[model samples]
Target: MLTWIALTALLLFSLATYMAGRRRAVAVTAGKPAQLHSLPGYYGSYAALWAGVPAALLILLFAMFGGRLEAGLLRVDPPAAVQELTAPQQDVFYDDARAIARGGTPSETIYDGALKTALEDKAAKSQQISSLIQYGSIGLGAILALAGVFIAYPRISPQFRARNKVEGWVAGLFVVCSVTAILTTAGIIASLVWESWRFFQAVPVHEFLLGTEWNPQIAMRADQFAGAGAFGAVPLFVGTFLIMLIAMMVAAPIGLFSAIYLSEYASPWTRSVVKPLLEILAGVPTVVYGFFAALTVGPLFRSFFNWIGAQLAGGSFDGLAQYLMQVQNQMALVAGAVMGIMLIPFVSSLSDDIINAVPQSLRDGSLAMGATRSETVKKVVLPAALPGIMAALLLAVSRAVGETMIVTMAAGLQARMTLNPLDTVTTVTVQIVTLLTGDQEFDSPKTLSAFGLGLTLFAVTLMLNIVALRIVRKYREQYD
Candidate 1:
């Protein structure tokens, strides 16, 4: 509230300063604005910058100090009962006081009068500090604006370069944006690496990277029946790759063929109708696909497999009946197939664009040499678009690897090492979600394992992108 109020007051004062600065500039020009150094709007904007920047900095300073001030004020001397808490419990007490001061119930076991009196004192101190900061910032801005007007009014001749200064600030803003993006990426990587390092300290890196088992249940008490958590990530990666492979298998050929038809074979009206209808599949939520996979596709596949199994069971291939019966409502194939459907638009749209980008002269040349349309597409256009198509496929693979909801609903959360697409499997994303779902302690390896999984997923996706880049660059040289 204080921050917002300060900013609003600062903005209003800046507007007033802008008006005054523009009026002063015109007055300096003896009512002939054309003789002024820069445009009236530029002068006004410069004055507004002088009026707001100092005040904005002050407001930011206050916000940076506000949290520590509030926490210190609330935590000082506390109540008798809260002061008697253990170190950890005292942290909780301060948290409770902060919550209560913010209109929540007090969780500390203290007297009501003491709690009320402390909260009231905290509120009074907060108000006093906020008002002081707010008014002081506004006053500072007023002084700065007045000083700027005195200093700048005489300098408003034709030689002044207000536009250059403003453009410099604009360039600074761009630099700030670029730095912010770099910092954000660095922060994410740091957090992931830090937590993953902690997890690896508790669970061996080899065990996590190479072990096939992925049970992550940790027993809380000594008498608990759970074994030490197995942090093996192999099954997760394998399952992820299996499902991704299946998804790509289903999506690549189908999406590529669809793109080919739309780009090469389909007439204008046909392409217009079919392209959007096909792309609509991408707009459907993954959860909807999850439901479709689990409720519809899984059962259909199982039933169809069972019928096949039954037919073959009465013959020498009776051993397949047991395997076919294992096909259930949740499996990698179902999730993969649905995920493929979901990714069709990504592939089709990219491939279509890439195919369309192929030079028409190449196709014409092929046709002029007596090649058919299909042969021209296969021999000329496809090779030219191959790099782009490969990029699209890898992009789809990355999407498949990162998918969560569809795998959760259509593929069971059992990490198993098997080639059976009909069997249930789990992926890194699914386990990451499972590991972090409840009130799990961050210090526990079970909880920190999510960060580990995230790091692994990041590495895999990064490697894929690198490979795709190499392929694109390699083929680009050949074609370009």
Candidate 2:
């Protein structure tokens, strides 16, 4: 509801601004430029931008920080009566108080005595305080808005220098919007860095980086040994590479061949018909691909192997026997094949654009020298576009590695370090998703593991992008 209100307010404010500026322009134009003190439209726009932009920013700020602000304000020291409880117990007490305020009771043991009585008292006080703060803020906002209107109205005069002021304000807004995006990216990186630092405190950095085992299971009690908390993330890395390789094997050749055929071989009419159809492949939701992998592709591969076995064994073989005798159902082949299908359009479309961007002069030069079309494409055009193609393939590999749904649904969740493509395995993203997707405590090693996985994934993707950018730069320089 607040989102709708904000949207409505922004639209109304913008429209009013446009109309006001238009009216002001007419008034200024009615007289000579020298006779006019200032442009009329400028005054109207000044009022509109001032009214809309600040209010929108306030709404955004409130939505982001309101709960935290309220929590901060109400974080009073629990009456001395509750001080005897341990830190965890105090947390429990505070949670209970908040729940009680909302007409709910907590299931945790409420230490009977002053602690319980104080909790009930504090709950009422916190609720009243929160209500007062909310009402006061709304009143303040309304008063400020009225003041802004009063200040703006008197300046909406013929002599007012509203145009210059408003233009300057608009330019400032543009800069702020750009800065906001940069700040958001920095904020995400900072948060990941902090969390990964905490994880490293619990698990040694070397163990995480160079250890070979990846068993993440830990005992619930801190006093007990953390069984299988082996920090060796090598198996996860191996699985990530293996799965990515399988997917790339499927996607790269098919996508590249499709791109080459579309760019160099297709007639104009065929290109027109086929390009949109190929692009449509990208629009298919990844979850759909996940289901297709698990329900359709996986079973189909298993069936194909069974059939192959039956043919080889005079039709006397069972499914499992056939699979064992002829083929592996969970081999990297199935997952890679499906992943390749998903990537075909991504590679083909990117490759096609780069190929098309190759100057016609080069192609014409090669053809004029009595070179065949294939020879021209291979020797001149493909060579020129190879760097871009490699960049695209690298990007596809990154996507495949980070992909969660396809692997989670089809690729078995086991964290096996085997190089065999036929063996079921998992990737970092899959482990991260499973680790964090439940009623898990935030401070637990299990939950914290997700952040470690995320940090690693981020680093890997970042490195790949850097390499691709460098390669692209080198290629661009060569051609230039």
Candidate 3:
């Protein structure tokens, strides 16, 4: 609340500084705007940026790190009662004190006697330290903002080059944003590698990569009845690809053909209507798709297959009939079909844009050679759009590989290595969610295995992207 008030005050101050700078610029030029090197608004914006940027940076820094600094200062000199507790207990004690200071609820552990007294004393100290940091930072930020106004407002003259300075600041802000994104990606990859390395220390890399089973629930103690965990990731990889293949089988052709028709055969009115209706499927939530899969498509497919099985029950295909009869609502086929329906918009939208991007001159030239519309589309437009179509398919494959909710709801979480789409299966993403769903100890192989799975998925996705990029580049050269 204090920070928000400070921010609001700083905003108002910056606005005031902007007006002062603009007025000063016009006054220095004898109220003749033509005499200024840049517009009066540029001088105002320059002053506003200087007043806001430094102070905003200070506020952001304090907001991000103030609590940690407060905690560190509080822990520098602990109470005797807190010193007597174990490390974890001391952490809890500090947490309780901080919570009390902030008027928030702490842990359920009831405190009494010396510990309770110590908590109260520490809470008071914490509150004092927190206020000191908050007020001190706000005060320092106000001083910096005032300093910026003094430094910038006096420089508002005819030859001040305010626009160039403002552009430089904007350029620096863009550079900062680009660096932040790169650093964020680097941090994610590094954390995944470090945690996956720890998991590999407990579970052999070869076993995780090649072994067939994937039960990750290990017994917590020696005498427990639970079996030792199996960490084979082959089943996960198989199921992931099996479902991906099935989804692509349903998505690729349909989405591509839809794009082709929309771009080539459909009239403008038809395209306008059908395009958004198809793209509407993209905006639907994945959870909703999951529910649709579970409630509607799964049962519909099961009934249709069961009817087929009944027809073949007493025939020569009795064995096949029994297998088909046993098929459940939750299977790879249902999930893949639903996921494909979900991906149709992604492929269709991107491919439609790509196909339309092909030069009209190519189609005209093909027609000038007496080729039919279909022949022109097959030979000229499709070849020109092939690279972008491949990219769109790659994007769809990535979506399918990363999907979880639909697979979780429609496909039962059974980690079995089978290509049969009729069987229940699970994907790596679903297992990752399962492994880390509840409170989990990071030291345990079961929890750390999520990172291992994530790393593997990341590697596969990267390799697929590399391959796709190479294919795209190769085709692009020919087309260009």
User: Which stretches in model 1 have alpha-carbon errors above 4 Å?
Assistant: 31-37, 73-104, 111-127, 134-155, 222-229, 473-480
C-alpha lDDT (0 to 100) for residue 339 of candidate 3: 93
lDDT of 2 by residue, 128-192 (tens): 76566555554454455445555675565566677688879979979999999999999999988
Per-model lDDT: 0.81, 0.76, 0.91
Report the lDDT tens digits of candidate 1 across residue range 1-480: 756776787788788878876777677778888886688877777777776776577667757785676566556556675566588866765666555545667664653566556556655655555556556656665676567656655655555676676677778889999999999999999999999999888788898899878898764854443244478899999999999999998899989999999999999999999888977877888888888998999899889888888777767777787678656778888899999888888899989988987888899999999999999999999989999899878888988999999998888999999878888999999999888887777887788889999999998898888887787667667645
* Deviation from native of the Cα of residue 270 in model 1, angstroms: 2.2
Give the Å error, residue 103, model 2. 7.6
Clashing pairs in 3: none
Supply the global lDDT for candidate 3. Answer: 0.91
Q: Count residue pairs with overlapping backbones in model 1.
A: 0
Question: Model 1 TM-score?
Answer: 0.88
State TM-scores per candidate: 0.88, 0.79, 0.90
Segments of candidate 2 deviating more than 4 angstroms: 1-30, 33-39, 51-135, 153-161, 306-323, 326-328, 473-480
Clashing residue pairs, candidate 1? none
